[model samples]
Target: MCCALAVPLPVGTAAAIDDQQFNELKDLVTKLGQKIEKQDLRIEQLEKTHAQDAQVHAQDQKTHEQDQRKIQELQQKLEETQQAVSNVQTAAIAVPVEPLPRVPLDEATVNHNFSILGDAEFQYAKTSGQHGTFLFADFAPIFLYRGGEKVLFEAGFDFGLQNNAPNSPGATTTINLSFAQLDYLMNDYVTLVAGDMVLPLGTYSERTAGWLNKIPDDPLPRDLLPGAGVGAQLRGAVPLGESGKLINYSVWGVNGASSADGTGNADQLDLGGNVGLRSDNAVANLHGKPSGGARVGWFMPFKPHYDLELGLSGQSGEWDNAGQHLWSAGVLDASLHLGSTVEVKGEYIRSCYGSDDHGNVRPEGWWLQASYKLVGLNLDWPVINNLELVNRYDSIHDGLGTRTRRYTLGYIYYFSNTLLFEGGYEFLHSNDPTQKDQLIFQLSYGF
Candidate 1:
């Protein structure tokens, strides 16, 4: 169809197509206003990071509740220090305190041996001349040995049972070997001590413990000394400064105790008067000469807890065995403690036998004892807190001077530290006028 014709022309054909669609609609409204300002700045940075994660989880739950209240106040102070150590272990007197800081023993490597200690006793006696004696009486067992800084040894044995008189149907029992010693040490002030010894003479036959005696015997000058002998001794100790004082010494040489004569089968432990030398632990020497002695002491310088001990001892032997007769002795002992609640012990012993034989025989003695401690009066009463209270006075003289005056009174109760119970009452009195005024009653149980 190649032939066309047009006519009208107005405004140059609509102003050039409306100025190119108005410049593309102004670039699509400036690209949606820059994408709504980048999505409002990413929603305000995610709401400030969710409020800083809820304020750091509330400060970690308040620091885990103050560390659980400091672990419940350290478990309630460890249960009140374990109930005060269970009330000081049931209390049977001993109260000091604080003693668990160890680390001490190093006596040059300490080699030990033996190490046993024992005690047993059960006795009852009644007198008014004789007749009421129950006996199982005594059993010891001591033994200790050490060999570190130079040797040491000690031994013990004793057993007794008797009847032959009070109801005499014959009972007489025996077993004895009451001390076998040996010590060497020759250093810190020397020490020697050999064989059967134990006559250090004073403190109730060598430093206490005849069942811990709160009385049920052991006070009448303990048989005028010489209760053990077969000896050889030197003993030691001397340290007098640092305020502890101390100066102890012993000297010996023995085989000395005598006076026996009921001869026949021979082994008796006093069926009245030392017949076979009382079953013999020592006490067998009768003649040849060889009795020696000495004891010197001092301790604790007055008061560091209040204690003091003083001693003096002596002996001379040969007491009848066909070689004539001669004997001698002297001892004076003392002990005093005050802070552990009173204690005063004493002894005076003076002996002689056939002083040159003018029909010879002389005897002498003395004693005193005291005790007190009702737990120092702070008593809350655990049976008076292990009680105590004791008293004794003694005398015995004869060899022709006669005299006999005894008096004892006692009470002990301990209950632990092994165990204890004792009771006593003696009374005697005599100047002879036919003599025979007695009254005794004792009961015991050591442990």
Candidate 2:
């Protein structure tokens, strides 16, 4: 409803416009209108593209929501499955299972029930004014058999190489049965032993055999006693109280001493000749009397490896072919242990022989020995700690007319618990010219 008024041009402006100019201006307006229409079409196309993009975005958002819901549902299912698995595991742990059957243990068989043990030694000796030589090579083997729970059999053998004579050029090998015995445990406090048993004379023959002798030789007085006796013995120990103290005892009956040549001569006396057959073809005891011996010992322990022991032993029997003579022996032994470092022991032995020539011949001796271990110093040295110093004083009077005394200083080097190297120097004093000072070395092993 708007109206426009067109005013006539001025006289100068009208004159300036020609027909050609008018036509050119109309063409320029037509071209501008066409450009405006193209611009409008481009704007409409852009709007349509924007609309399509919005529709696609909406569809994508819906798909995303659906996917999110599916994910949450899957998470819920996973939690439920995990809880179910947890409950199953807990229930399984609470459940009980049956046990397997047990098999009975078998008894020990005899083939595997026995043990073998023993000792061996080698020695070198030199006396004054004499050449040093290898003294002896000795091997002792012990066999132990467990017959049953309450029965045992044990035997020991000694094999040695020695000179045939004092100045012999060759050696003689000897094999001797040291001891063979069967032990029957009568009860908790008693054992019965039979056969050639080691006589509990003074504990020396039993306790200091072979390598057990700290010195290379036995004590001079031990020669008076028989090492073993063909006998039956009853031995046992009794607890004094609960304070780790006890009393041990042994009683035995055996074939006693016999004449070496079926004679009553004192010089021909033999302590170990009663076990063999005689020239008279008599397989019997020459004295025709069984000897009896007994020993009682008291042991007191104040602490581990610290103890004192005192023992008294005696034996008597006829020793002549006429059975008119008798032999008797008595021994008193004592041992003291201050600790693992100090040890002292000794024995006094006395024996009487009733004979035709010498009347009642008496042979007696005593020996005292002490040892100290260097380990007591706690020096932290392996070699010095394994060393032990030993000393002994021994005296003996032969039933004849000879008396001898000896002092020995020794040292022991231990290569291991059961292997030892020992050396000693003896200072001798004796009435007999045959007795002389000596030096001895021994290598000993025990197993």
Candidate 3:
């Protein structure tokens, strides 16, 4: 009984143990299956993630290509716009325009670029010995240059009917060319001039042109001195010592006869010269500042004021009334102006004539004139630009003519500084009755 019981128990125990082992194995297999399913789910999830990543990368690549295409399009448009801008610039550059040519100045324009100006006067007068209506004109043109050089061209014409004797001959009308010259200015210190220039022998002769004379009749010494001749002149100024002083000198070579009435002889030469000195800071009323110095002058071939030649004029190569006559004269003059308004002048002349009949005739003459001008007269109207009341007294004695005394009362009406009308009443008492009392009127213009 014990053995049977033990065997059964053992079998039962073995069977129970086997069942437990089976159950554990089944449990482990189920757990392992669940694990495998979880692993499969994880693998699927990883595959989906990788697919999404690939799609996003493709989209990104497409977007990048589109951006590149846009960039290329922008670049092409930019190049096209640049070419359009260049074409527009070229079109602008191709426009046509009218060209202006530069012109050069010609000789005719240079010669006639300057203007000419002048004035004329006609006077009707009745005097004791001479009575007629006379026409006289003076023309002066000023030429200016860019280089500060200047030239003054001057000329004059005189026309009149002269009837010294009403019954002797019908009044004869004549025209005379009074003055012609050109003044060339090299500088303030020097000048060169040619043509009919005034004589430099005396102050009166220098200032006694017919159109611009303070006195109607010339001073006696001026009448005796040669007034005008065709000539070449050189004038200059030299400064003296430190006292503010200078000397002005003028030297000239001239024809013996008037330029209008010139003799054919070209070899005839008349020599003249003048020297003047003045103090420093001297002022001239008409000429502004002047070189200050005393003045001295000499001349030859003396004559009366008009149409009166009283010297022996001769030539070099002939004699016996066939050739030219030789003549010589000497003159000295001095003047001083204390101020602009006061002037004192004196002159002395010695003349010798050589003629076919008389070898040499010596004649000496002189004159002195002093004048005081009241300059500072202001008038209300333009009719009287500046009124100057002048008082002058002169006396002269000639070896061939009688002594003379003259007094002059003068009035000048100036329309401008350059335009003036002058009238004077003169009283003359001469040793000769033929040249007694005289009256004169004049109108003058200058620029």
Best by lDDT: 2
What's the CA error at residue 371 for candidate 1, in Å? 1.0
**So what's the TM-score on candidate 2?**
0.74
Q: Can you give the lDDT of residue 72 in candidate 1? A: 89
lDDT of 3 by residue, 1-447 (tens): 888776645567788999999999999999999999999999999999999999999999999999999999999999999999999999888987667895655534455445444444444444677765554433333333322236656665555555657669565666665556777788888888777666565555445445455544466644444655555777766665554355656666554421112232222222221111123443211111111112333222122211111111111111112234443456666555555555555566765444434444455666555555445344455544366554456666554456777777776666666666666666777887776565556677664
Candidate order (TM-score): 2, 3, 1
The parts of candidate 2 lying over 4 Å away from their true place are 1-108, 163-170, 279-281
Q: What is the TM-score (0 to 1) of candidate 3?
A: 0.50
Q: Per lDDT, what order, best first? A: 2, 1, 3
Candidate 2 lDDT for residue 347: 96
Candidate 1 per-residue lDDT, tens place, 240-289, comes to: 88888888988887767554552211121111132223455665444556
The whole-model C-alpha lDDT of candidate 2 against the native structure comes to 0.90
**Where in model 3 is the C-alpha error above 4 Å?**
1-108, 112-173, 182-190, 241-244, 257-326, 369-386, 395-398, 419-421
User: Which pairs clash in the backbone of model 1?
Assistant: none
lDDT of 2 by residue, 1-447 (tens): 233356555787775676669889999999999999999999999999999999999999999999999999999999999999999999989999778897543446675768999988888989999999886678999999888777899999999987778876987899999899999999999999999999988888878768887888878888888888887999999999899899999999998888887788898788887874677786778777888999999999999999999999999999988888899999999989998999999999999989988999999999999999999999989999999999999999988989999999999999998999999999999999988999999999999
Q: How badly does each model clash, as a count of residue pairs?
A: 0, 0, 13
